[model samples]
Target: MKLKLIFLLTASILAFTGCNNFETLNTDPARSSETQPEFLLGNAEKRASDLLYDTYFNGRIGMELSQYWMGTDKTSDGRFLFTNDGLWSGMYAGPLMDLQEIQNYYDRHPEETNPNILAVSEILKSWIFHILTDVYVDIPYTQALKGDVIPQPVFDKGKDVYSALLVSLKKQIDVLSNPGTMAIRGDVVANGSAAQWVRIANALRMRIAMRMADAQPAEAKAIIEDAVKNTMVSVAQDAFFPYNVATVTNRFPYNDVDRPLVEFAVTSTLVTYLQSVNDPRLPIFARPDETNGKYIGKVYGTEANAPTMIGLSKPGVMAYSGSAKGYMITYAEVAFLKAEAAARGMAVGSASAEELYKEAVTASMTQWGVTDAKVVATYLEGVPYKGGTWKNVIGTQKWLALYMQGIQSWMERLRLDPKKPNGEVLFIPPASGSLDPEVTDVPKRLKYPSSSRAANAINSEQAAKSIGGDTQATKNWWDTL
Candidate 1:
């Protein structure tokens, strides 16, 4: 009798739960979940989407600090690197915190198993792991985020983190492909649809695998092939978050800010690459330097007289415009990776590497609103063509797409064409902060945040001891390639 009563009450409330605020407070205690599993699932989906936007704050901002633009002034004591303490706070504190919680909750309950949340969380995990492994290089992971249960987390080597992420992603994608699907009540791309989320998950697998190129070429090639079969082969299938004017929640971060006053200016290396290739995407990606037509970027060490920009005084509104959701992965990036793999005779899809290379180049230009047939024709015509200049073709495209994003463009400068090294370098130098140049062919890795040394002294010391050579000069495990 009691069970019957509980079941009846639960069904009644689930019917009306949507009419009320999404909070489960109104739900009948005994039968709420059974009565309306979809409602709880819907609310969870909403929370997951919220997680994606927060990354734009942490990750996107770092990219901006990289070389896309110069800062208005020093962001951190390590101004040379535009070393924002916020990067850790934002990446670890925000996106990571929620992800760790959500994943654990998902693991225990295993209820929200649809592709959207699965893909979303899986992709989010990949990025979070990427950020930590790439920047901090051997920070906590193996025992990290065990939550209150296990407080002192052990720092796993970066290669371990990458391997673990790949395995986890591969498993989840397989389960998602033909398993009991979750109830997706909200607008969740990764979870809401199986095909799309699978695509994203596969793309992420390829990405992380590519990072392992130097350390585990065989493993990397296998993973890349696995991903290529199901991943982003064309722009129609890129995993992107598009910002809409109607939705202020999704607007691009730079929409309301004064572009010129923000202190971040376009860098010389970037401008030179853009101008050299005569890429039309330059005008679309950056505002013109009104003072002198030639792109004038300020060096990072400048104490005064910042570079000039046009419409500096112009008032701009945050009306539905230029802002887009942060990019998790793009078709161009995948294509470039394939091109590299092809150059090395790695496993990939049907097209010859050269064919894929041209496709990748055109896809990048198209994304930037460069619709001029002539420009497209010239880019394809290979006028900027220099023989054996694979770096010229692939590196520039990679850099161009990663604008305002952070070290990715600069990273290409380091990695592309590792065989025949080039004298060219790309980086966002330390501004009035570093005593001298990075002294590396490229900016290697960020300095450990000052707070790490002060606040988390004991644990950080252990990390520094374990990771070894934790300096800007220290090469990350993945960067070995």
Candidate 2:
């Protein structure tokens, strides 16, 4: 009892020293520590570390499975070791959960509202909602983050979520504009300031608004225009996270598994595109095979064909980077969005979609370390978007720009699929031998996490009744395009 008292006394001294600094200290929802503004900002940092992980899985995990990319695929489930659920809870539980909790804390302590927390939440929330929409189309949004106070939150129409995000992004951008917003105070990101936060928030708004192209083209145009009128002009303001081996959660484990259980490699389809374009990014994007010394690509489900040597997996095919970075919105993505919006007749700075396509391609190459001016010049030889349909113009430009970025790439294709979901896929990834690739197309949506169904059984039952079956194939609003 004396030791406990001593510990309490020490804490009180420190708390008292810091107490005067606080405008108003409040009781945190679950924390016994009297959280002042600094603590709340520190909490934002802790959450940012967690939020960084969201990019790898929700943003990028399922995306690899959807399209034919240069490297990695287990989502097919043919031979790729990862099961559907393995793909399900990849990173959502960690980061998404923490973000919700932080919001709850903020809600309880309104005085703690500062530029960093407000802006970070607004920007990251758009990302969270974007990932959820990509997977399920519609989800609980109008009533989200309510915790036990609201046990059963109805799913918002996907369109509604997009609208809500648009408002949040705009509001938060203004909050982060003040120089003193995070200055002379605690900070989450080391080099982050209020201006940087606004840039990211605005850029993300541009991306989100463009996502509504098909479902609400006119609305998409208005939002895009608002963004271009007030948008980011460089990659420095990019809202991205740096990843390293020690920061494993911030990186995608698909390409960095610890043991030798799952075996998948680069996709042949992507290899062909890289080679055909003679794109310099191929080297940076994919690692060469150590055995054959050839750039070998693997079929999604059939990663282990060493014995057969037909689209087989090799040990050193993929060049793993322990310190690789995760991408959020960047200049490359913005260019591509512009290209896409232009294709759909969304005017911005009077640049045509075709013009934007060329610019986007060049910008993307530059962002991926494609520096040599001559090499860049040569890579731009191909005619930009010779095809007329938005699918060919916007879709193809986006495909190249979104390499390894995640669900953003897959959604582009989903957006352009035939109105009735019947069309010829130009880049049909090498199919999972398990599924008769000719017959069954890749799924467009993921089933809900089994745990959610098991624990929230009552809610799950209602969801099933409302949405026909919570299967992996249910198309979300954007995917249903």
Candidate 3:
């Protein structure tokens, strides 16, 4: 009891006397610290790439919605069930947060921060927001990623988000054109090449411009003209984001066990269209059925009468492999944008619509390993471009080129072919028996995730109401087709 009293009296005296250095003494010297902004670059890139090509976002949600691949044993996604809201939650909390930190680092350490790195970071952030706004329509934009300062960010209108992104992209494009003293480090996407990022930024501008062309023609025309005048990604300079080897820790999501290709089969919509067009890429895009050694696709959303896994065709060997790269902004996509711009009577340099269309097709063929001149020429001959049917031609061809890129293809589809007054869509709808009566056609936009609603109820409710309800049928601001 005497020792306890002594200890208590000493501790009380120390607490009062040594409180000046308490924080320093209590701080753990071995605790992890924040990395330099450069180190965060690759992490942000990988996270965005994962969101683009991962099993949940791309495989289940994107590919299913775009009708590129359909579930074998599972059909909910193909039937327009977007239960996994990781596309929203994961992005805002994961990559977007990383990017925001990068910007914050620059803001805090302006003298130390490289302007080029900041430019790249802004470009990537814009890219991510572009995806988000397109998918969710009205998402947390202006007030997003503020951490505790604004725990619940108000959602920005989709049009306003697009406009802001375009302005930001234009500013960053100038910065990348004239980079800073420090060379970019840990750049897994472009090998620290500021030039490559310029192309990507311009491509993004073109994509956004095209998406908004129908709704905001004057603004879209200005952006499109500016991007086309600038240097765009060429066929030789395609941005195919790399994936690691076929390891358990690092592999393409389609080949990884978590969301293996075995769970999905080629959709009949894709197979039938490819076959009708005599597309040589059919074999390259889909593997022959294991049962009959024939390329047979499963009808999308055929829950009741879906074929067995071995009875249907899976993704091709190259595509299903672990090393297959994710498409960031392909040359083919850029060429298609140029072609569309030209076809729309917009001034886009010397190339005519037909010439650009052929180039775009060739670029896509080359991307999928079809490089033979004769084969490409033959394929082009099969689908000649017509000015009268330019929209259908470009839309169909772009969809085909964007075979595995689910979200991008879906966006293009929504933009190119708007839902008719009678609720008709140009793209294939899910099988009649498997569709939720509430959603009979292809989804226009993904509903805000339930988690988002739960966390930011008032903001989510307001955004949903502003964008014509939080449902798959609601069209985004850009999808005025």
Clashes of each: 17, 5, 0
TM-score-wise, the better of 2 and 3 is: 3
State the lDDT of candidate 2 residue by residue for 108-155, as single tens digits: 887765555656655666766777766666566776656567765666
The candidate that wins on lDDT is 3
* Residues 370-449 of candidate 3: C-alpha lDDT, one tens digit per residue: 99999999989888888777887887889888888889988887787622212334356777443555678678888888
Q: Each candidate: what lDDT?
A: 0.58, 0.58, 0.83
Residue 332 miss distance in model 3 (angstroms): 0.1
Kindly report which residue stretches of model 2 are placed more than 4 angstroms away from their true locations once superposed. Answer: 1-63, 68-93, 106-110, 178-190, 244-262, 300-319, 387-390, 417-425, 429-439
Query: Could you give candidate 1's per-residue lDDT for residues 109-161 as a string of tens digits?
Result: 67643454544555556666776677777766776666477655666777788
Taking all chains together, each candidate's TM-score versus the true structure is 0.77, 0.77, 0.91
Task: Give model 1's TM-score versus the native structure.
Answer: 0.77
Q: Model 3, residue 147: what's the lDDT?
A: 61
